[model samples]
Target: MPTPTKTGKRTSGLPAKTRLQWSGLSLAIALFLFPIILPISGLDGPQSRMLGIFLAAICLWVTEAIPLTATAVGVIFLEVVLISDAAIVPVGADATSAKVYFASLANPVLILFLGGFMIADGAAKYGLDKNLAALLLRPFGGSARLTLLGLMSITALLSAFMSNTATTAAMFAVVSPILKALPTRRARAGVALAIPVAANLGGIATPVGSPPNAIAIGALAEKQIYLTFAGWIALSLPIVLVLLLFSWGVLSTVALPVGTQLELEMKVDFDRSRAAIWFYLITALTIALWLTESLHGVASTIVGFFPVVAFLATQVMDGEDLKKISWPVLWLVAGGIALGVGVGATELDKWLLGSINWQSFSVLWLLLLLALVAVGMSNVISNSASANLLVPLTLGLGASISVDQGTVAVVIAIACSLAMCLPISTPPNAIAYATGTITNRAMLLMGLVVGILGIILLAFVMPFYWYGVGLLPVN
Candidate 1:
């Protein structure tokens, strides 16, 4: 037993995790005060204040000293109090209205995400996701190698329309029995690794696929650059497909190996009840509206609310079902939007742009550097937070570089999703790691290969491909 401390608490009373969280919170405060105590040479008062908030947000987000959503909402509150019109110590010229910061909580991008979350939640409630996986997996046959491909393909496809984390959970729930049935542990690890790798890569396929994607879209919208939902799919889907196939090949070869034979028993039991059927129709119509935005001239954000209204009004998804939606994810994205808004409103972006001589690096090198930095930061922090910090700054580079804001924002977003080396890198990665089938070494090796390949694709190949195909504006 541990000795009691002065405060009558045991010396070992707090868990290591709790102690670390408190330490992180302390560090965040110190970092936040740094800019205030020692102002930068060129930034104005408002800029310095924004810089402090930005640093503090990075520390809190990276450490998870508080709940991720708490840190997000905290950032918004600080921005309003410290730099908005409501600030106690007034700063001239750049201060924005408090409403602007608060409004981020319901930004159109978030509304779009909310709609996606509703559909995903409804799918899970009605057993639609699992049933779809079962129906889709039938064509790939029983061999472990082919099954790996089938599983990855389906995971990626589902992740495109759903949260990658949710997709991984749903997929894993479907396959956990098969994993236990596998004779060799190595085959289990291989099969297990495929789900997260596919889900992470697949998240880049559409704007609503992951939080980072929504972060990118939200940031770009503030700059008057809008990417239609289908447009994002067109830009990223090809790369997502190629990376999934590549990862599938690596996992099948390195983890599963040759001569590994396994059989799977997938049960398909989709709900055919009245409410489930109504949900299905609403979901299909919403997705169709999202995809045909160009033809219909309906904004994806407006179309996103269709399901929200339809599900609630018809009782297809009642209040209980609504309660199941991932509210934190939406808030996290909103915090990112508010961060971008504050940075832009304060002209901190201009100051930061001037602080760096971005022209010193060639276009190719700069793009590579941005993607590499995004991957590195996201490996240890929430990818959404990484995008939150990086996107606004990258968008500022539009004035300094010849590349369009869309390309830069999307590159960073996709690069963030490429981080999956550690269990902490993503919820999907954590879920896959929790199954105890794969070792840390196995995950790191696969994540590194896939991450490097993805970086190379984003930095070198995709830009030119986008330009050639007219997806990117030619410089």
Candidate 2:
């Protein structure tokens, strides 16, 4: 009955807005509480509850209810104050040190990831990624579909050596100029979306392609499920090829124009600069080190560190540029590892797997179900955390089902990397969305379709191919 405003807007009380905000907050609180509250009280002890709380914190970060960095800090606080009665001690001590908070920080995998990022940052700053993209795209003869294929292949290849987010960002630097010079918005958007999809798809080609892959590899190694370089490649390459072709087909048929002309000048210096040569050399060494870990016993971290040192020593990138690296992402990965370790330490993974009913399903069906769950969870959580949480669970579940644990672990890891449903699902997708070329709705729709197809390939095709080719142990 109150009079309408000049703009014909209804007058709403402050109480109403406050109520709505409180309602949302309450819903979030409920979600955080439900897992712990609904479960049997004594079945999961304090450690298990703590793990659940850690996971809930990650979920809050992924959903943007809180900043991811802040969530990591929250994890440290929770671990110290609530989880254990153990006293804090100095760093460089044996077990039971205050450095426990930094336990995951010292992991070899983390060191390798940081070192790799340094190298990638150097490559990006030195125009190596741009040059590589230009070299690859230049030969496509200006056909949009062919150009799309070239972009996908190049991005995928780069992904094997670099972080998927970094690879996608590099690809964008090259492709954005081309898109801007195009005449139509539709063509620009199509190419823009294709770039990220390609980057994500390409990331499946190597163990170091994405965080999820690294997590899986590290987790399996801890379980003594060792896979050599050739072994992993034998399993991954076929899946990667099939998925890459599928992604290219989807973009060509669904989004991209058949006969679009590019008006931009493609000028790139393909000359091998000193820095580029050094980068290539470091990359080759890293790959060699990873492949020959058995003979040298040289940790991958040591191999990765050489590139970082070379980049700095050669003056390829300055200190300020290094500071701009994603520290929050590093923290998130650290916290995810801590939480994963905590889960195993507390035996929550075993308890959770024990509760699941795996009796009725075949091993293949169980693996497929796990893959679907990994894909869905990765969409809502950071893929690294998804991998951390699920890999151990998959291992335990596999034991319960009397199937090979390593096989289930690898499947979950791969599926975690396949998340493409939303920008928040993976950093590469977020990087692509930030370019302003693709709408959220378009990305979501296209990603959902692509993700479904990817899951299908992972579930039905990959296991057979891996086992048939002698890459994976047959049951």
Candidate 3:
């Protein structure tokens, strides 16, 4: 019913596109609908329905196929309105309990953890993060590899207690200046890419390092399998160290030939000695608190509060800068937590378990499939959402295959953080991409290489170590 425009062009009520683009869209649409047409050959009921919703959500997320927040709301609406029948309900009548549905939003631990992000934001605004980076990189000004190590180490250390996005943003601010000082374009590009890659890689070191870790930990605890700080470290640290080394090797081998090293021009105006002492003391105390949680019977959330209070009281950051925090991210995480809890509380997990044909697949094979699916899904969706959707599925798969459910669940959790392939893949990648130092092609190539390496490392090494350390029971 559309009319022609003033120029005599037809208005089909569709966005303008070239013929080739239209052809591609047509092909994509066909491919998308292929599964739906062949009903008998398609996925089982719960899985088919869930996959349809998940794919739709992912398409919207990846292509801006729609507004992101709107898509998230759409997911909730679809689940509540379209899929709320007895067959599709997650917790059944109990799942709809106001207490469980809104639990994540009201969770005290989650709120306290959200406050940590505000502290990090405050640190970034006041230039404290820059000061810290400068102090760390000053000694390594003459050596490229040492500079890389310093940056990686500092990022890893910071990520242990702060969000990876906050750490990447903070480190990017400091590293950008150093990159500009470099004489060669190649060196600038290489360091720019490496900084974010390091930040993302470092995030696997701690439970608080990324949302996926937090969700996995929380989900497991819901099942009554509590992971202690020491237990998490035992399972994760080796994976972190090995992956760090692998990443270093890859980046080092692909080094850009340096033409000239820049003179260290930045002056240290901040009291490095005092800041270093306070930072270390606070860091040590925080770690101690996490490690001794079983003895104190105190939650990590309660322990995390002390550092924020100390950081504020010591004038490390002003109260006003705290407003810069990503309140939306906090909300997003809370929403995800609530959604995940709802899924578990309902019969959704059990339904998924009942529907899968696990007798046809081996445990190792299933785990590999999950790893690949997770990495691919994360590339399109938020890593948190990817983990949230996949964790229940993985847990369900594990039970069907007779594998240790906790181990399989944790593996998927850690693997979800392995999104390194694109700008939108993870926040650290976005921050790095924003610098304009590296090309999208270069970032993708590097991320592809590193991502594969990470998967191989996690797939083989993590399970063995987890079982050996007693964090996971032998199956």
Measured by TM-score, the strongest candidate is 1
lDDT per residue as tens, model 1, 1-475: 7888888877865445677788889999998889888978988788888989988898888888988899899989999888998887777764799999999999999999999999999988898999999899887766878888999999999999988988999999988887887778888898899999999988899888989999999998998888899999999988898998898888888767676666777788889999999999999999999999999999999999889999999998889988889999899999999999998898888888887888787777788899999999999999988998899778888888787787898899999999999999999999999998889998888889988998898988898888888876746
Q: Which residue runs of candidate 2 sit more than 4 Å off their true CA positions?
A: 1-55, 80-101, 180-185, 228-231, 255-264, 270-280, 291-297, 313-318, 434-436
**TM-score for each of the candidates:** 0.94, 0.81, 0.78
- Highest-lDDT candidate: 1
Clashes of each: 0, 1, 3
Candidate 2 lDDT over 1-475, as tens digits, reads 5557789887752333345444544555676567656776544445445655555664555555565666656665555544444524221222233356556666666666777677677667667777877877778746777877888889888887777888888888777777776666666777788777777777776666777766776667656676654456667777778778887787677666668655335678753777667767776777788778769877666676776677678766568867977667666666666665555555667776676688888767777788899999988777776776677556666567766766787788778878887888788888878888888888888778877877777777777777776667647
Over 126-189, each residue of candidate 3 has an lDDT whose tens digit, in order, gives 4566677778777776667667767777887677667788888878767766787766676787
Q: Candidate 3 has which clashing residue pairs, if any? A: 90-346, 90-347, 91-346
Kindly give the stretch of ten consecutive residues in candidate 2 with the minimal lDDT sum: 89-98
Off by over 4 Å in 3: 1-96, 257-266, 271-284, 306-322
Q: Report each candidate's C-alpha RMSD, comma-separated, in the order given.
A: 3.7, 6.9, 6.7
Scored by CA lDDT, what does every candidate get? Answer: 0.89, 0.70, 0.66
Model 2 C-alpha RMSD to native: 6.9
